[model samples]
Target: MLIKWISAAALAGALLASPATAVDLTVWAQTDLSPSASLGPVAEAFTDLYARFQRENPDITLKYEILPGGTEALPNLLTAASVGNLPDVAILDSFWVARLAETGHLQPLNDLWPAAERADVLPAAIDTMTFDGKIYAAMFSNAWRGVFYRTDQAKSLGIDAPPASWDEFLAFADKAKAAGMKPIMIPGADTEVTTLHLISTFWGFGGDLVDATGKPIFFEGANRTALEKTYALYRDLVQRGLLGTEVSTMDEKALRPFFYTGEAAAIANTSSGLQQMYSDAPTLKGNIGVFALPLPDGGRAAPILGGQTWGIFADDDAHKQAAWKLVSFMLQPANLTAIDAAKGYLPVNQAVWAQPFYAGDPLMQQFKGIFDGAKIVKTRPPVPIYPTISSALSQQVAGILNGTLTPTVAVDQARDIVMAEYTRQSAR
Candidate 1:
């Protein structure tokens, strides 16, 4: 099993609300996986909000359905839309925004949100959900990948703080290596994790996956340099035995034992993983800390902002209006603040950060700093061929890390495959 850590309340609520005669509004979500487990605070809060919405609008009912995962959810959504059987609203991964809208299955929200309400959201978030000059969805929650280190381990290593730059990180890794601790654990089986780390570093070096025109640009000069540096780091770490060969066979879950047991000093993970760690290993709480991933030379740090959005499906007018209303209500600062605080996620709405929950926690405050300075945050290009592109990139990255393919050759092949897919999708 992939072990999707979802919300317990969402699952309970899903089962508890099966009443008769309710004007059901279908919602497609990935937040209601485990019946006894909670996805996070956001899902719990949404579960409550849905209940409240049903209460207020007695005539309009809502039925929430859970999608399997990002990969399955996207294709299912497209298939449903093509058959004119789309749900009322769907929670979509931010990366699918452009591609979904291009298919004409999503409703434009330009007139739905007022100028003032629109301005309340983080600018980068708003920009990410917008496609071809039209806003198609509302940015809701965000997760950023960064360096998660054990504070006690740093102290034991005679390091007072997390590394502020790539060079410093390398030095820290060397120290951890000397102490017989794995500097970091990279999960090769779960390509998303490794890919995110690699991509963040690429962005730190000023490489971009897409050009200004939203075209694939994987073979550019900046990207080549990024790959070379990444491959060098991999080879050096593996050759020195600082990162074990088992890493190549380890899935996402495989690294958790190492991290929880203190065999690994640090890991690059998203905020969601942070939440899960706190739940699964309460002993590690307070000792864990997050820092922005370092940049090359003396450049500023850049974290990849991963998040989700709420999209209204092209459906009946009544359902569309209800969905929009639900999205607007959820975006309210109070709601966003509570949900983010509970779920350990950064609120996409800027005003939500000013709330007491965010203001009072030092850890959260530090998190906010990373979120504020995240300049390279972007959703993957919204293309129907994204899965293929992702898989190709993952294979190439795995090959580079395992020395099965030269970095140059691997990247070049990835670029060719992605470009071809882009052209094929465009011509359709």
Candidate 2:
């Protein structure tokens, strides 16, 4: 036994010392990690960081694969998992973490990650990467959503401040419309953004899309009532002309042109828009002001901490250690600050938030204030059927906006569409 242990130790030392024996691990993501002129500064920073990592750890080299977002990413990951050919790490969309972790193939990283290092992230942000009470991934970047209004537009329209309460929001809209300005626009062109802009409205009324066990329960009991009320608000907004029918056709990309052209007084968007606002309409950047969506009876909006997370899938011990090393390095305060600040992504790492970038940027400070005021932050549920649930709700939401379905019928139909998949996920 002593002789065998010594031999194994010697082999390990030799491999560690040899450059040819370096671990070459794979990392897959929907986002571009390589430096590209078309991509933002964050990607460029990440590209530099990757090169730095390779230099620092001469024993590891990462193989990168950029996959198609939404349409093919999950399917590719699933196929890879089924064939036992999964990468050492993958960038998981917030919604994909729950589904991918359900495969029982993703290794729970809690044992490898130190609790002290984990504490640097927001507790709610960390919750997004958790499934079945195990931490499956590490979340570093985030896109915090809120309502962005033209500050000068609001001032000229005689609005003293952004709406603070639901009643105030309604009054503010009335004033803006009276002044020949379109009130607020919430984009509904896709499954994700459609629900994202208004889901917090449902949350404010004390409703969560799922229960503690990760079952779809938004259609049950008071949750049903809250959702109905939430949907009714949208239907009523359209009926009253406060929110436009064109919203159903508008995506986040469309929102910039609408707002910049002096068409819409306000729009709901993510923190990343801070950079886009400057790039798309530098003249309007200073005019823009951000506020959380006003919920009924003064309930503060709980910012949904949604973003890409890194999950390790490697089964071998050497690859696991190497993958985690790369992930942890990328998530370090300085590295995260470099990328997140440059790109205007809200930082999930508290240490990154403390950096001068966030402190100096007024737009980011507003987002941070909105993020800090909330009590119960929301993340996509830890269930595989979340995309199904989101899709159903999004479709019904569009129908509700178009007057093709009542709020009750919309909720009922959405429930019918996703229940089976929800049940299957629950069973797993």
Candidate 3:
């Protein structure tokens, strides 16, 4: 017995003396900032950021796989997950967090992440990556949608400030129209943009898309009222000719020439796009201004939050920790600030906001204020069914806008479709 114990102890000591094996981590990242949306130098900027990470961590070998945006990345990841071929770390769209979370493929970060790290994240922004009481991912980049208007146009039309409420928005629209300017441009041509805009309007009208358990509840009394109010707003925009004929065909990018050149008085888009616009047309910088999207009476304003997040996939403790280290490195204030500045995304960490770069910039200051006031919303619910639901809403709303369906019929049909999906999901 004594001889056997001695031999075991010797083997344990030898094992402990062996050098730790190096870890090789593969990271999947999107080249474009958003799905179908590209800001200046996003891919190059991320490459530089990854090079920096490599410099700092000499031991870990990094392999990067750049994925295409818009309907490509998620499907790729899903396929990989099915075969257990997922990368160690991946940057996921904020909306995909919930869907992936439900798959059980993602590692819950609540155990891996520290509470102190969450201290300064805007609560609603944090909600984007959270599901089932655990944070499944960390926000890497951030964006919010707000009303962008030509300040000079508004002032020349005798408007002292941007609209504060839906009534005020309509009144301002009327004035802008009288002044020979298109009031606002809604990007209904792009399904995601259309979804985000309508979601904002619905939320502002005190509507919610899903209940806490991720069930569709938009047809409930108050929620249905909010939906109708949003529908009415869109109908009014069409009737008043505020949206105009081109809205049916033009995506957000197509509206840029109009908005930047002062053909449109106001437009709503992700806050990051503001920086891109300013960069592309320097002359329009001082002429532009932004504000949170206005709400209807008895409602609250919350610009829908959009951005990318990094999550871990490997299950082994060592690999998970190694992946987390890379994620944590990317989240460092300076590194994250540079990435956000390059991509035109707002920083998710509040500490990054304190940096002089954001504080000194007037546009970023406005974003800071928006975050401070909690005027943010995560438009998509954290459910597997959201992508389908969003696509359906986009199509149904387009129908409503084109006069093919009334709001009541559209809402009822949408509800039935979602409930059917919910039942399908339950059966699975």
Highest lDDT model number? 2
Which scores better on lDDT, 2 or 3? Answer: 2
Model 3 lDDT, full chain set:
0.77
- The 10 consecutive residues of candidate 2 with the worst lDDT sum are 30-39
Q: What is the C-alpha lDDT of each candidate?
A: 0.73, 0.80, 0.77
CA RMSD of each candidate after superposition: 8.4, 6.4, 7.6
The candidates, ranked best first by lDDT, are: 2, 3, 1
Clashing pairs in 2: none
Q: What lDDT tens digits, residue by residue, belong to model 2 across residues 115-145?
A: 9999988897777677667999888778877
Q: Compose the digit string of candidate 3's lDDT tens values, residues 126-176.
A: 776777688888886777776788777889888877777778888888988
For model 1, residues 27-100, the per-residue Cα lDDT tens digits are 78875421212655556667677777677777677777877775677788878878888888887878777778
Lowest summed lDDT across 10 adjacent residues in model 3 is found at 33-42
Off by over 4 Å in 3: 1-20, 33-41, 298-300, 374-376
Off by over 4 Å in 1: 1-23, 32-43, 420-428
Clashes of each: 9, 0, 0
Clashing pairs in 3: none
